[model samples]
Target: MLNKKIVEKKLTSKTYTPKVLKELYKIFNLRTKQEKQKLRKILLELISEGKIYKDSKGKYRPLKDNLAIGTLELTRNGTLAFVWTESGDEIAIPAEKLGNALHKDKVLVEIIGKWYDLPEGKVIKVIERGLKKIVGTFQPRGRFAFIIPDDPKIQYDFYVPVEYFNNAKPGVKVVAEIVKYPSPTRNPVAKVIEVLGYSDDPSTDFPTIVVKHDLPVEFPEKVLKEVAKIPEKVTPKDLKGRRDFRNEIIVTIDGADAKDFDDAVNVKKLQNGNYLLGVHIADVSYYVKEGTELDKEAFKRGTSVYLVDRVIPMLPFKLSHGICSLVQGEDRLVMSLLMELNKEGEVVDFEVTPGVIRSYRRLIYDDVNALFSGDKEAYRKIGDLKEQLFLMKELKDILRNARRKRGAILDIEGGEVKIILDEKGHTIDIIPRYRGEAEVIIEEFMIKANETIAEIFNNFDLPFVYRVHEQPDPDTILQLKNYLSALGINFKLPKKIQPKLLQELLEKTEGHPLRSSIERLLVRSMKRAVYSSTNIGHFGLASYAYTHFTSPIRRYPDLVVHRLIRNFLKTNGKLTKKKIKELNKKLTKIAVHSSKRERTADEAEWDYTALKKIDYISRHIGDVFDVVVTSVTKFGLFVEIIDKYISGLIHVSTMNDYYIYNEEKSILIGERKGKIYKIGDKLKAKVIKADKTRMQIDFEIYNEEENKSNIN
Candidate 1:
């Protein structure tokens, strides 16, 4: 049978050499017309799937032959695009070679030659359009209208006919769905689907973003109906066959604005120099059964998107914020992971069980952090849970230390942004999100729980979904090593790279002035953490087995994890080999879908947050602020305002003197004055312009002397 697997096995078994159709047929030992036809069809199918590519000479070969399928990544300016191939090679695509492919479009690129040592390719086919609709501002043209896309990488102003304008007036924000994709000579055409009031209206932000990212805004009617049927609170029948932890002092700790409390914790200093730590996560899987409308919607959303203004939930509010939320004093069903750990923070034993719990108290991060800092009022609120709170802190420290010792990268700072809004829904401030002792405690406890649960499933060799971050590509690591050597740092990379190697390098550069630059480069060298059915292990965490087990209310993977745990418990871990085989296929699909949706969520969050950041910057135009140079390119410098936590560009053209880019040092130097601007360098800059439609902010070097001269 000439199926995909058989063909793949035969083709990959030996060294691949470019071959023609007749040669392939001969190789397959097919003489009959029927067999030859089947072979040809199969080969065509493989080509469509990007498994094989036809060389420019009309010979067939595997995709390794200078051709690959991946998303098209346009530069911030959108003049050039690059595609990171499946093999991790970044192939540059020139504007003319793009062939109408938009940014983030899944595309097949045919590599014709090399540009600056990197493979340069032209988009041969657009596999899939990344966006169904785009958010832009409506501009009236001669006989039609044009939409200036908010996304910089869109690269074209969409032309809209007067009839398709949907009554949207000039200067109004509108959502446009492309009716005709662009060609080399002409722009794309679109029809306005939604007419948002104006660019400045805050209410339009979520709608604009939701459509832009294809995010599920409202729950389906079927999903809402299912949620409506779900009980408002945990019932007596729900407690059957579940462990009771209601009597224990469990507390839910989260940010002040958190709507759903998913995980709760309680700690006890056990006898014989051990710690009993309990992690109780809301049992979202119980309420959202597989194959139901609710489950389908949750799977589609994959995870909750928390915007600056509101949350786009994965599940309906009736369940996510009601029964599934671990609210204080309310009985809630939970999948509880109880682990007994030694003083060194190694889990000696653990148990996972369906349980019922009533949160004893709800504590916010601020209060807990204040209590840890010896604030009397904060401690007074702690009251009866003071002893347990301190014990939790001790265990948190031990766990963090153990993780550090086990070679996990702990010092890479990735803080969130706290957007402060006023009653008018305008962004007042954007500050770095604070994660104090309480947040650290929760993070450590959740990680321990996830590891413990994943380890148990791995020990049994079960088919399960694992959160994996594969090792960095050898080429990327080599580049990192070379870059560090230029900075006068001798870093050694092993033949087989390991997390410990990079972790040690980070440790050595902990307090170095160039630590941020190093961190940025090191992070770039590593692959993204993603969901996978097979466990290759998470290199960043240095864990042999790791899975997301908490935050079931917000994340679909956690809910699926909960369901798998329930299955394991019901079957007593006696799954047959055949059953596991079946599960492998199902789990693989789930992992891929969940991972894709997760990336979507991340991108949506980033776009929304960036929009708000630009809005905040618009209010402060011409104001001088201290900024740090986060990146330096030949065209400009990217600087983040120190206090506002907003980044903008200081274009090289605006500088008083022409600047030359120092490629080796990755800095910009003035042609005459030789003033150097490099990463981590602090300088004062004035915001020159802020364009919401373009989603861009331009900054210029602020000269105090020039300002005083002008005033005088």
Candidate 2:
């Protein structure tokens, strides 16, 4: 019999390096094949239990004393990077060294080699599994089956017995729960818990993505019941002690397809030649009290997810689209930020208070934009509001100029794709969502309101949630400068990096051939904005303090801000120190949870859009289109179709001659023909293949001369 104690003692004796399996077997003096098998099993058990570790060379060794804890990031090509949670240091882990640790898994890694600039580590133990369930296509092999996961990060297929099929047959999309985790010698076992539908059914894509991302699509029954008990209209009793803005000419400006309205704007010219701007947001905290089922559910959702064809709201429809929504001509409770600003766009004074508002009109951005463009029909539709719209344009210009002077970074080249779906949920067309003057005006107002509220709460010295964006790392900035220099654009980095320097560079390269590419790179160089309990000044906005004070119906953090302001109002600004301390303890957790949920929602939205794009392109396979090379890698060049904005790979194998990648020049060179392809190069290509399951497309360069000769 193989004993763990004896093997451990021998392995720990005097080993600074890993030991191979054959050497371990020889050390144990195992004579028969059966004994060797038992010894291997014991070694595997020890490795799994974190008593030992494996390196990339397939050698086992004892774990080091100082193991770093981090989250594993796995790429589609099976590469791994470990991001330490505490120190923010990154370590590279070879694919072979990651035994059972999956993508995004919290793991304890032991440093094994320091040959490269960055340390290399091997995952010794998986502290927590990131994925508990997976969505995939089932492939039945007679009595048993295997599930190929849709997520490329899951490198292994799941095994399922016949009895665990849950009535699902082959070629069906299903969600499976992992029954047992993976091991070296055996695949992971899973049971089909939900049979979504056919793999070819377009309607199943939404639900499959929803389940895959663990997004909460529906509210709990208890939450729905609580929503049912809430009043549908603002009564006289509900307006007590609330400032009434019913007579104000407030209007909501949104997209044509917008359903839930959470914010409204009203502007008036004051006697002092300044403007009085009113930004009223839905008071969601009024209905959803603390310690209630609705509040619990709202906190869990964190933020509303806007997918391609649908919206998974944080709150129920009864609140998001009904009484709590700031609909036109409806009495709704709100938290209003009224600011008195001078002509220079400086807020002279501001007041935050709970209020009752009745929006006079609900306007779409297109119509408002047309009105500004002097369209007669649009002017007639706007009628008496045209003058106020003109005044809004003036205020918007002032505010925009003020932000520019303060060095707010503006990278506005990219636009979102709006997928048009038929009644059957099939994608018909994809168009870019335009952002015009009206959109910019609304954005400016909301930003001012958010900043003003943040300053108010910050002055109170109370615990609150803030929207923070940290400055980019120095190394990332230097990399951007180097890339720009390589493209023949002379750029210099200031001793102290500021938003102004980047903004000026963007302006200088605005009309350049690589303008869009440069903007994309600069955007990537910036840090992602997130929610935090402590106020870290927003670097991109150039604001000293900021919070999300608008859209309470869709975002939970906004609702929390509203609650804090309301409590301050109710107590006449006399909150006890003990109460403030309790809120600080609670707000910290909420900030972290909300930030994570927001990221998940953004990822889900991007995934759904990509899937729809793949489906859309699948119909036009073999069609040649003009494309621009967005990036070049060792494998191939990534090109984006001109008008369609769909990106695909032009694999090196598709070319007639062999190609070699030049890392320093960021280009691909043909070995025999000496042909070179670099970023921003325009060429024609045919869509050779589109894989809907993988959400990928492949393209080949079009040979125009050959085609012409063939036609003759």
Candidate 3:
């Protein structure tokens, strides 16, 4: 018999070196073909056990040098996970290869294989558990219970002992503290620690999401007390060294729901026919000092989470919406930026300083847009300020043209939606969000301010938090090109993708029926924007330097930026080498933490919005709506309603008749009737099911069927 133990001992020896399979066979003296085959199988088993790794040269070696530690980030469906190493390499780990590692668990992975030339790995050991508690619904069965997690990335239902229920009733949302992690043969064990509320109640939505993402809803006692000590209004002492722009026609333009105004702007046409744009942002750092309890809490939250029905401010409401808010007719301290531009909208010179600004007017986006569109009431409301408004619009157009000329991406909308809820917390309407001229003006001005601030710090060689978006992966772009080609839209794959390349593609499909679909696909091909200590530039904005500096009231990075700017101004841009070194190290940690928090906030908001959308759909079960097939798969077709952009799955099993999925053609043909379903195909689908617990909405094609619900 071939001794597998001997093979293991050989690899674990003090001086054993990596060897090829043939060399290992010779060393083991396996002359018989069957013995050699057995040796190969043993080696494979050893590799699977994380005892060895196959190098690029096809030689087997120990896993020590090939090991990388990172958080095991599981996909939503839990079929796979990825570990992004410190070296910027993402290693794909199949579900079976995870070795019982849960989502977000810090684990050591050994690179063992390759998937399409990308590094693939297996978790060898769990270094640390990243998730402390899980939010889920408690379900009791006789003596034991299970908590089904709200997060889709969590694959296993936690097993809870009867005594550990913590008085949580069945079907209530609860927070479960992880008692023991899951092993290969056992499920995770947890104890119910906190009961949120009834799982199915409409009011429970906010708390559920808050617990699910572990977001803070209330300020700590000390932090609250600290905030109470702050002044209710800006004082003369606070504005002593700051330039005052209270009398300027500075105005804040935002949505009607906006309570906290962070930025206000004023514009002027100078003697040289150049435009002077002044952007004043609320000075949040002036109050939220570093190393304080309030500051610590803000750092932990990283960013404010804006959801369907709530705003989880980074700072308390006192600072976010009161003392720091630049409301109309109130004096507010700010860190201001003044940019001088000629007809071409190029920044000829700029000034960054601390200032005091009183917003002369609070303008809503709709009203401003209506005024620019020649609405008589909107125009009449602004009186003699009409000249300044015209100048502002002109400056906006000039800035927009400059961006386009510099190859900046002009159009890529996020498909945002505004969900209106009734008094009973039921979704009454879902209005698709659109950007008008006023919104665009604010966006352009913010981008310009962010760029200028980043450039200032970069020139001073200071460490700062930057908003970065890397270029899209070449493989993703190639895939997009293939998809477009299949749609008969001939797009040439470029060797180096400039910002204008994607814009051109979007323009080419301007009036096509699949324009939105193509835009979405193109957007996905691009990289996600993130906070980073290192500057890589923002590919989406086509900016060489960019950072968020206007929303200090809501974003922690902006607060940090504000502090840094204050320090620069106070010391005349001079800092000790030690301070710079300390900042460089600290900012890296801040960047990583802020990026993660931002992603969590974004996901939580999406989940809440989707839940409401699903809530609305469930009430109108059996109602048919026009849908366009967004994606075609072997299992089903994913479709989206045109107007509201609500998506649902048309499971293949619901098709009454079995359909043969044609992968190459990206279509499904009915076996009995030859009915075809393909991407971009317009069809009417009846809403069959909407399950909130599972976060699923399902539809079935409405044809000459006996009844609508029969397919369900």
**Candidate with best lDDT:** 3
Candidate 3 segments whose C-alpha is farther than 4 A from its true place? 1-70, 84-92, 108-127, 165-173, 193-199, 704-712
| TM-score for each predicted model, relative to the true structure | 0.84, 0.85, 0.86
lDDT of 3 by residue, 1-712 (tens): 5676888888878799999888998889889889998988998777644466666577877657678766778999899898865334578999999987898887778889886757899987775687889888899988999999989899999999998999988888888899999987899999998888774567778877877787888899999999999999998899888998887889999999998999999899899999999999998999999999999999999999998777999999989899899999999999999999889988899999889988999999988888888889998887556788778888899999999888888887666789999887888888888899889888888998999999998887789999999999999998788778757788777799988888888778876666677888988899889888889999988998899999999998999999888888888888889988888878877887787788888898889998899888888799999988888899999998776878999999888788899877778899998888877888889999987777889999877456645666
lDDT of 2 by residue, 452-552 (tens): 98998788777889999989888889878877865767777877788988888988887665666677788789888888888988998899899998988
Tens-place lDDT digits, model 1, residues 1-712: 6677777666655576778888888887889999998888887767655677666576776766766887777877767898854433578999889987998787888899888767889998777777778888999987898999877778889999989989999999998888998877899999998898787777777787887677888777887878788889788899999999999999999988999989999998877889999999999999889999988888888999988888999888887789999999999999999999998999998889999999999998898888889899987887567778888999999999999888888767553678988887778888766568898999999989999989988999898888999888899998888667655678777899878788889888776655666776898899889888888889999999999999899998889889999999999989888999888877876887787688778888988887788778888988999987777799999887774667789999988898999887878889899888777778899999987776789999998998899999
Query: How many pairs collide in each candidate, listed in order?
Result: 0, 0, 0
Alpha-carbon shift of residue 383 in model 3 (angstroms) = 3.9
Worst 10 residues of 2 by lDDT: 81-90
lDDT of 1 at 137: 92
lDDT of each: 0.85, 0.84, 0.86
- Full ranking by lDDT: 3, 1, 2
Better of 1 and 2 by TM-score: 2
TM-score of 2: 0.85
Best candidate (score: TM-score): 3
